[model samples]
Target: MKKKLKFNRDWCKGCGICVEFCPKNVLELDDELKIYAPRSGDCIFCKMCELRCPDIAIQIIETQEESDEEK
Candidate 1:
Protein backbone atom coordinates (compact mmCIF):
# COMPACT_ATOMS: atom_id res chain seq x y z
CA MET A 1 0.00 0.00 0.00
CA LYS A 2 1.05 3.58 -0.64
CA LYS A 3 0.62 6.47 1.76
CA LYS A 4 -0.37 9.97 0.78
CA LEU A 5 0.26 13.04 2.94
CA LYS A 6 -1.84 16.18 2.84
CA PHE A 7 -1.48 19.46 4.67
CA ASN A 8 -4.10 22.09 5.44
CA ARG A 9 -2.21 25.29 4.91
CA ASP A 10 -4.99 27.49 6.17
CA TRP A 11 -5.25 25.62 9.44
CA CYS A 12 -1.51 25.28 9.94
CA LYS A 13 0.14 27.60 12.41
CA GLY A 14 3.71 27.01 11.21
CA CYS A 15 4.53 24.98 14.28
CA GLY A 16 7.34 22.43 13.97
CA ILE A 17 5.64 19.70 15.93
CA CYS A 18 4.83 17.64 12.86
CA VAL A 19 8.30 18.02 11.43
CA GLU A 20 9.98 17.05 14.69
CA PHE A 21 7.78 14.05 15.36
CA CYS A 22 7.86 12.36 11.96
CA PRO A 23 9.73 9.10 12.47
CA LYS A 24 10.64 8.81 8.80
CA ASN A 25 11.82 12.42 8.56
CA VAL A 26 9.22 12.96 5.88
CA LEU A 27 8.34 16.45 7.03
CA GLU A 28 10.14 19.76 7.20
CA LEU A 29 9.69 23.46 7.65
CA ASP A 30 10.37 25.85 4.78
CA ASP A 31 12.26 29.12 5.09
CA GLU A 32 8.98 30.84 5.68
CA LEU A 33 8.35 28.45 8.62
CA LYS A 34 5.49 26.68 6.91
CA ILE A 35 5.44 22.92 7.15
CA TYR A 36 6.11 20.86 4.03
CA ALA A 37 6.68 17.25 3.15
CA PRO A 38 10.04 17.24 1.51
CA ARG A 39 10.92 13.57 1.95
CA SER A 40 7.42 12.14 1.69
CA GLY A 41 8.78 9.23 -0.34
CA ASP A 42 10.20 7.90 2.93
CA CYS A 43 6.91 8.03 4.75
CA ILE A 44 5.71 4.80 6.35
CA PHE A 45 2.16 5.97 7.11
CA CYS A 46 2.84 5.87 10.83
CA LYS A 47 0.45 8.78 11.45
CA MET A 48 2.74 10.22 14.11
CA CYS A 49 2.78 13.58 12.48
CA GLU A 50 -0.94 13.57 11.98
CA LEU A 51 -1.73 12.67 15.56
CA ARG A 52 0.81 14.98 17.09
CA CYS A 53 0.00 18.02 15.01
CA PRO A 54 -1.50 20.62 17.35
CA ASP A 55 -3.24 22.45 14.54
CA ILE A 56 -4.45 19.31 12.81
CA ALA A 57 -2.57 20.36 9.76
CA ILE A 58 -1.04 17.05 8.75
CA GLN A 59 -2.89 14.09 7.35
CA ILE A 60 -1.78 10.66 6.21
CA ILE A 61 -3.99 8.42 4.14
CA GLU A 62 -3.43 5.03 2.56
CA THR A 63 -3.78 4.81 -1.20
CA GLN A 64 -3.40 2.29 -3.95
CA GLU A 65 -1.45 3.29 -6.97
CA GLU A 66 -3.10 2.92 -10.36
CA SER A 67 -2.30 -0.38 -11.95
CA ASP A 68 -2.12 -1.36 -15.61
CA GLU A 69 -5.58 -2.87 -15.38
CA GLU A 70 -7.00 0.53 -14.52
CA LYS A 71 -5.46 2.27 -17.49
Candidate 2:
Protein backbone atom coordinates (compact mmCIF):
# COMPACT_ATOMS: atom_id res chain seq x y z
CA MET A 1 0.00 0.00 0.00
CA LYS A 2 1.04 3.58 -0.52
CA LYS A 3 2.03 5.31 2.69
CA LYS A 4 0.83 8.80 3.46
CA LEU A 5 3.18 11.61 4.40
CA LYS A 6 2.07 14.84 6.01
CA PHE A 7 4.17 17.93 6.45
CA ASN A 8 3.22 20.64 8.92
CA ARG A 9 4.74 23.63 7.14
CA ASP A 10 4.03 25.95 10.04
CA TRP A 11 5.91 23.72 12.44
CA CYS A 12 8.85 23.07 10.12
CA LYS A 13 12.00 25.07 10.67
CA GLY A 14 13.51 24.15 7.26
CA CYS A 15 16.32 22.42 9.13
CA GLY A 16 16.76 19.67 6.48
CA ILE A 17 17.09 17.06 9.20
CA CYS A 18 14.36 14.94 7.66
CA VAL A 19 15.68 15.45 4.14
CA GLU A 20 19.14 14.29 5.14
CA PHE A 21 18.01 11.33 7.17
CA CYS A 22 15.55 9.72 4.81
CA PRO A 23 17.18 6.47 3.66
CA LYS A 24 14.85 6.16 0.72
CA ASN A 25 15.59 9.68 -0.50
CA VAL A 26 11.88 10.19 -0.16
CA LEU A 27 12.21 13.79 0.96
CA GLU A 28 13.56 16.91 -0.64
CA LEU A 29 14.01 20.62 0.01
CA ASP A 30 12.84 23.43 -2.23
CA ASP A 31 14.76 26.54 -3.17
CA GLU A 32 13.23 28.25 -0.14
CA LEU A 33 14.45 25.32 2.02
CA LYS A 34 11.04 23.93 2.77
CA ILE A 35 10.92 20.13 2.94
CA TYR A 36 8.70 18.02 0.69
CA ALA A 37 8.21 14.38 -0.28
CA PRO A 38 9.53 14.02 -3.76
CA ARG A 39 10.05 10.25 -3.96
CA SER A 40 7.06 9.33 -1.90
CA GLY A 41 6.53 6.21 -3.99
CA ASP A 42 9.86 4.88 -2.73
CA CYS A 43 8.98 5.37 0.89
CA ILE A 44 9.34 2.24 2.91
CA PHE A 45 7.39 3.81 5.74
CA CYS A 46 10.52 3.52 7.88
CA LYS A 47 9.47 6.58 9.90
CA MET A 48 13.05 7.86 9.94
CA CYS A 49 12.07 11.33 8.75
CA GLU A 50 9.26 11.56 11.23
CA LEU A 51 11.47 10.44 14.07
CA ARG A 52 14.43 12.61 13.10
CA CYS A 53 12.44 15.80 12.59
CA PRO A 54 13.27 18.18 15.41
CA ASP A 55 10.23 20.30 14.69
CA ILE A 56 7.91 17.29 14.58
CA ALA A 57 6.81 18.52 11.19
CA ILE A 58 6.73 15.24 9.31
CA GLN A 59 4.05 12.65 9.95
CA ILE A 60 3.40 9.23 8.40
CA ILE A 61 -0.29 8.49 8.33
CA GLU A 62 -1.34 5.13 9.71
CA THR A 63 -1.36 2.10 7.45
CA GLN A 64 -0.80 -0.22 10.35
CA GLU A 65 -1.31 -0.55 14.10
CA GLU A 66 2.27 0.57 14.80
CA SER A 67 1.88 3.75 12.80
CA ASP A 68 -1.48 4.34 14.46
CA GLU A 69 0.22 4.32 17.86
CA GLU A 70 2.62 7.02 16.72
CA LYS A 71 -0.24 9.46 16.27
Give all candidates' CA lDDT scores: 0.76, 0.77
Off by over 4 Å in 2: 63-71
| TM-score of model 2 (CA atoms) | 0.79
Could you tell me the TM-score of candidate 1?
0.78
Number of colliding residue pairs in each model: 0, 0
Window of ten residues with lowest summed lDDT in model 2 = 62-71
Instruction: Give, for candidate 1, the lowest lDDT window spanning 10 residues.
Output: 62-71
- What tens-digit string does per-residue lDDT give for candidate 2 at 21-62? 888887888777877876777888899889989999888875
For model 1, the local distance difference test gives 0.76
**Candidate 2 local accuracy as lDDT?**
0.77
Expressed as tens digits, the lDDT of each residue in 1-71 for candidate 1 is 65578788878888898887778887888887878887766777788888998898887655686421110
What TM-score fits each model?
A: 0.78, 0.79
Q: For candidate 1, what's the RMSD?
A: 5.0
